[model samples]
Target chain A: MNLHEYQAKELFARYGLPVLPGQVAQTPEEARDIAAALGGTVVIKAQVLVGGRGKAGGVKLAHGPDEAYDRARDILALTIKGLPVRKVLVARAAEIARELYLAILLDRSRKLPLIMLSAAGGVDIEEVARTAPHRIVRRHIPLEGLRPYQARALLKPLFREGSQLTQAADILMKLWRAYSEGDCSLAEINPLAVTPEGKVLALDAKVILDDNADVRHREWEIWRDPDEETLGQRVAREKGLSYVKLDGDIGCVVNGAGLAMATMDLIKHYGGEPANFLDIGGSSNPEKVTAALRIITGESRVRAILFNIFGGITRCDDVANGIVQSLKQSPLPIPLVIRLTGTNEEQARKILSENGLSATTSMDEGVRAVIAKAQEVTA
Target chain B: MSIFIDKSTRLVVQGITGRDGAFHTGQMVAYGTKVVAGVTPGKGGEKLQGVPVFDGVAEAVAATRANASVIYVPAVFAADAIFEAADAGVGLIVCITEGLPVRDTLAAYHHVAALRSRNGTGRPRLVGPNCPGLISPGLSKVGILPGHICKPGPVGVVSRSGTLTYEVVQQLTHAGLGQSTCLGIGGDPVIGTNFIDALEAFAADPRTEGIVLIGEIGGSDEEEAAQFIKRHVRKPVVAFIAGQTAPPGKRMGHAGAIISGGTGTAAEKMAAFEAVGVPVANIPSEIPSLMAEAMGRRRPRSNRAAAGKARRARAASRPRPAARDRARPAAKRARARARKPARRAVARAAGGRGRR
Candidate 1:
């Protein structure tokens, strides 16, 4: 749910935060047109989700419309971190100034929204925290949210006095509004820049909305980037499964979040790599299991498919029936191993046995079996 | 003797008329939980599975004297349900609902913290917004845990996962290490109960001779729990953490289960536990052996043997699942069939969304 720089700026503008005017263009000609309309030196940034876009040469400065087109074309042709630039954000370049970092995020430990401000900005906050921890100041916002006085106090260390501090505090308050109202897990302005004229502007914006809050904020659907999702991930999501693709040979399908991760860990521990992490979730039926199997088998790199279901509310029999039904439809070319236990496990074992597919109940045994099978396939 | 629930827990099922509510309510009642009443707005005066239904938690609490409440409402209404249960003076609120917005949870959590019960008994102890509720083996089953896999004994288990809890509990039972109580505090980033709360309760319970903590990569709760275990817990505690192989920035199914900003990783949490002298199990199956070894190390040889004998005798004396309860799968399968249309609609609406 990470918003691109341009989308984050759009949200920042909606919340009345001071942001430089920017337009996102999908093509080099569009970038040139936007630069021409702005009539100034423009910065063209690749709109990929990964970090270090500038380090990857996906960000370039252009003096005019013609140069903007050239920069955009080069960025568009290049792929950064395996994700091609689908769009470029063209904005009027800001004058030289000091950079400061400001962010509002959900503090998992405190279970509250935390606002962090630092004199050091426009760089990786983690690097700053690691190298110069004292430069960063943090405050936890209670349920009542960030107070104006608290925002002013947080900015006082960065800005001593006058309109700069006032404007910075105002932007912080507005950023809180965008964060809370937009149901964002993180809203950041990394490089809250001060111009030579002393005016402050957010040079970069990154906002990540809380996905669980999507029920209330349906309008956030427009922010979803389809290009970011692989076909397997999209299908798994549509089927109500949690799936994350990784570069491994053993495809994992498990019942719970913790068990899924443990399975992946056990696979790695047993000298095998996991292709993906997929959780069928609680109360599974045949179709969901079928969907999970289909999604896993769709991965060509997956040499062996593993089903590690420790059924509680999710009946083992249901999952067994799903495996049986799925294999009947389109038999897997890869080695298939399953470990079923818990509720109705006897019946599930019987079901699997009848289909000529034996199962193991021990997780360690299953991991060893799957790793062995996967290696055999690889060999 | 359990940490949170036992035989005296007069339970109330919120959203009793809903699909999940009805199914799990049946399971709870069959497991010998005293389900005194049910709360389903607009269904007052009706009966669900022979339990009286009320329009509100206040009325339900007043009439039936239900001290504990389990919620199965949808995500949007879960926070309000918590507020209602808290306002009505329910002593223990276990919300089984998942996908509650963090904002709503924050509001509910703070609201409950600030309010005292009507009877001046203190604020209600909220267990989860997404969890399989606690179980006291043969004593009482509060939420959706399968009771057949559990056995009452000396071990107190706490986890942030549903099926993972079941896996570890079943392994403990198979290894002749029955549990005194098992609690799933849930896998949400912001839950009412956490590892520290459960660990404190386990530390105080005399019947809980040893503790088994199941944690995953996420918040600093596991690390904090490790510190608590080092300071307050005198009993032997064994730990197992999932997501050791999970990549950073990926939400591993649970809303709280992610490694963000280079913190909350499994390696970090595991190190925190190891630094505190707590033995961390590499896999779930290794938990029982670790617990046994830790407990054996704490007690003398004769006392350990005596405790094992006592645990075995107590497990033998406990009643098994009734024959009628053994016929549960058919009913459960029927309920699963009935829930397909609704589940499909929800999946359709939430297609390709981010992790819940």
Candidate 2:
């Protein structure tokens, strides 16, 4: 659900924030055209989902149209942190006299939105937090609302001159408004520079919209990349199960995420690796379990499968039926360890036992058996 | 003796009209939980499994005086269902629905917090908006979670982890200790009640003698709870932190299971618990003994021996590459150094053999 830099900046512009003029270029020709239209120094940046693009040589500068085209072509050709750049952003470069950092993010401990600002800019905030946390001034926005005076007070120390402080305060207030109204989890202006012309422009803009609020924001949906999804994740999404693929070899199908993770961890603890994360959720229907198993078995790395269901609303017998059906539907070659508990557990055990699959009530034994079985195959 | 539900706890099932809801509700009521009423909006004055079904939580509360609620509502309407239960003044709200939008949960959490602040009566306590709910083994069970794995005893259980709670309780049951109260606090990022809140309640319960806190990676909630336990908790507590060597930078089962940038990790949580004199266990099998030792029923055992054995077992259990990860890298280095001259000699001998 992460937006590209151009999309974030687009939202920023809509919020009335001062962002450098930019154009999203899907091709080198479009980038050259954009650079020519801007008629000034341009910054070409790779449009990747991950951060550290600049550090990974995904960003470059050009003085003229040809140079801009060359830079964009280079960035589009490059891979930043393993993600290839299919597009590049051509932005007019701003004159920087002094750089500053500004961001507003949710502070979980305080249960409020916290504004972080620093005179130092254009560096990873984590490193800044680790090295000199005191340099960063934080102000928690009260539920009552953010006041312009408070914004002015925060900016007052950063600028000795009154005019620069006033201008910075106005921009900060606008940023806070965007953060609150735009449903952003995070909005940052790195290298929020004061130009030689005595005006402030956001040299770099980053915005992370809350995924939960995305339903209400249709404009934000356009920024979503459909190709970003993993095959298992796509299948899980379609099947209505919360599935996140992991790197381990032991495929886990459980009733809950907490339990699913615990099952995966248990496998790891017992000397097995989890192939994927699959949660059948509260409604442990036969279809959901079947889909989950299909997704797990799709993973070639998975040598064994672990079925852990704590069936509260999900009956153990129903889950057992699902497992039996999955086994019947596909002649799965991997070893299976089933731990069924809660309501109808006896019935479930009966079903499994009838199918010649001995279910274990003991999780330790189940984990041990699964790990042992996986080990047998890998060996 | 249980912190929440017990034998006499009145229970009502929400979304009882749904197929899954009716099935689990029937199962739960059959399992001996006092089935007072059921709630499905616009379906009041009906009955499911011989239990009265009310149109809404308020009507259900008014008719049956049902103090406890188990929600099986869809994720879309889960927030409204929770608020309905809260508004109806239910003593305990256990939501079994997962995949609630983060905003919906935030609103629900905020509403509950606001309710708590406004009431001044400490009226209803929220368990989960996404959790599997609570179960009082041998007494009352509300959740759809498999109930047979647990047995009523003195070991108070509190966990952010749901699937493993059954395993923990199973181990405890096998070790001959029944659970006083077992709670799955939900694995959602912004949950209603946390480990410390449940632990504090467990600490106050006279029937409870010990606690087993099942912790996972992500967020500082566990570390904070561990600190609180050190400062305030009186009951003997055993800790088993899951995902010790979980691969970093990957979101596993829950949104909260990812360990990135060194913040809520198993190792860190274990260290925090250990600093507070709480016995930390590495494996699920080790939890029962740790709990026994904490309760003064067994002697403290060496974790080193268990670790060594687990390492060797794990190495033997995994693929060759993974087995190498568990191998002594220092030993590998030393062997590589010793083989340097041998490799040179072999190369020279290979040259001679080729010449011949």
Candidate 3:
């Protein structure tokens, strides 16, 4: 549900936030057209979801349309962090007098929306926190929304009570509107730049929409990146499976999201890297299980497939049936490990045993069995 | 003696005409829950499984005098349902629905909190937006928990997972242990109840001799719970954190479950639990043993009648398809038939998005 910088800025502008005027283009010619219309030094940024774009040479500056076109062409050809640059955003670059950080996000521990501010900007906030902790300031916004006086208080430390403070506070308030009004899970402006002309602009915007809120905001789907998924992910989405492919060798299929992660963690603890995070979810139908198995086996790196199901409402017998049918279709391409427990487990075990397969109720035993099978050939 | 629900509890089911609402309602009633009322907007005059249905929560509350409300509505309307329940003066609310919009939850949460502050008594307790609800063995079952697997016992449980909570509960019951109450606070990023709230309630309950806390790698909730355990809880607590080896920056199913910038890792949570004198189980199965040891050190069992009632009730409620004499495919097909309407309701309510 993360939006590219261009998309984020589009929402920002809708909320009257001080973001520089920008346009998204698919080609270098389009980039040139945008830059020529703006008639100023422009920043051409590659539109990809991955972070560290500047470090990856995905961002460049150009003084004119020709240079803008050249920069966009170069960025478009580059693949940063395995994601191709399909789109580029061209905007009038600003001369900055000061740069600061501002963000509004859900503080999980507090169960509240929190706004964090910092005097330092254009650098990773985590790095700033690690190096100069006092430079950053944090505030929790109550349900009543951020007040004008409170916004003033947030800016007071970064500035002496003046126009700079008022203007920045206004921008922070606007950022809150884009966050709350837009129903974003996370909204940030990394470099809230103060221009040489004393105008504050959101230099870089990032908005992570709350996926659950999509029903409320029907128009948000246009921001989806078409190429951001793997084949397994695409199929899983259509099949109603929760799957995230990872750079590992052990494939995992589990019921319930929490148990899936724990299964992966346990595998890692026993010296195995999980190939993906797959949660068929509760009361999974047989079709989903078949799809999960097919998706995992499709990946050649997978040396073992693990099924860790702790069924409550999800009947273990249903899962066992899925496993049995999958094995019948073709011999398991890799070793199989299962730890099935809870509701209908006795029936599930009977099915597995009749098929010359059995499951361990113990998670530790299941983890060891899979890791051993995985290591048999690799060693 | 349970932390939340008990024999005196009068329950109402929201979304009672919907698929999940109707199915779990039958299970709850069969498990001996006093589900006196149901609410489904336009279908209020109808009777669902002998329970009276109302168009609004206020009418349902007034008619049936149901103090506890369990929600099985679609995620889109879940927040409003909660607000409706709270507005109608339901003392406790358990939302089994998942994928509620976080901002809507924020507003709903604050509304409930504000009401609690204004009243200062019988404040609403929300269980989950994506959870299995909860169970008080032999006394009341207000959620989708397999009641047959639970027995009333000395330990009270709270977790942030659905089946994992049931798994630990199952292991606890399998080894001749029973539970007083178990709470699934859910896996959503913003939820009403956390480990701290449940811990405080368990600490005050007389029947709970020991407690089990199952946490996953997520927000700083575990750490906050650790601090609460250290300060408020004198009862011996056994804890386990899931996702120990989860990689940084990847969300492991739960929206609240991402490890951002090396914070909220299982290692940090385990360290906090250990620092607070709570033993963290190495594996899920080891929890019952740890709880046995922890309970054995401090107190002897006193709630014997409840335990016996739990055992008898569980024996009575186990799903009959596991008898093994029946045809397996027939049983599965029958179960699927029973689940279709509810599943379809859930799918339609889910609107084909968000984490299930």
Which residue pairs in candidate 1 collide?
Answer: none
Candidate 2 per-residue C-alpha lDDT over A1-379 given as tens digits, one digit per residue, 9 for 90 to 100? 5578888888888878888898999888999999999988999998887768899888898999999878887888887777778888899987789999999876654456789999889887778889998989999987666899999888888988877888888888888888887877678898789998888888788887765566567887678766566677778778878776667788878876666766777777777777776777767666787788888777548888888777654678988888788778776788888887777889998998999897877666788888888889989
Query: What are the per-residue Cα lDDT tens digits for candidate 3 across A1-379?
Result: 8899999999999988888888998999999999999998999999998778999999999999999999999999999988888999999999998899999998876778898888899888889889999888888998788898999887888866488888888888888888998999889998998888778789999989988888778789787665777677788878878777778888889888878877877788788888888889875566777889888878548888889988777888998998888678767767898899877999999999999998998777888888888888577
Best by lDDT: 1
What's the C-alpha lDDT at position B212 in model 1? 96
Which 10-residue window in model 1 chain B sums to the lowest lDDT? Answer: B347-356
Write down the C-alpha DockQ for each prediction.
0.57, 0.25, 0.46
| Top DockQ prediction, candidate number | 1
| Model 3 clashing residue pairs (backbone) | B19-B342, B97-B129, B153-B178, B153-B179
Candidates' TM-scores?
A: 0.91, 0.83, 0.88
| TM-score-superior candidate, 1 or 3 | 1
Runs with alpha carbons beyond 4 Å of true place in candidate 1 = B116-122, B299-356
Q: Which stretches of candidate 2 lie over 4 Å from their true place?
A: A159-167, A170-182, A282-300, A309-313, A327-330, A333-362, A365-379, B11-14, B19-21, B297-356
Give i-RMS (Å) per prediction: 0.9, 2.9, 1.6
For candidate 1, what's the RMSD? Answer: 10.8
- Write candidate 1's Cα lDDT for A57-171 as tens digits: 9889999999999999999998998888889999999995799999999987778899888888888899999999998888899787779998888788788758999999999
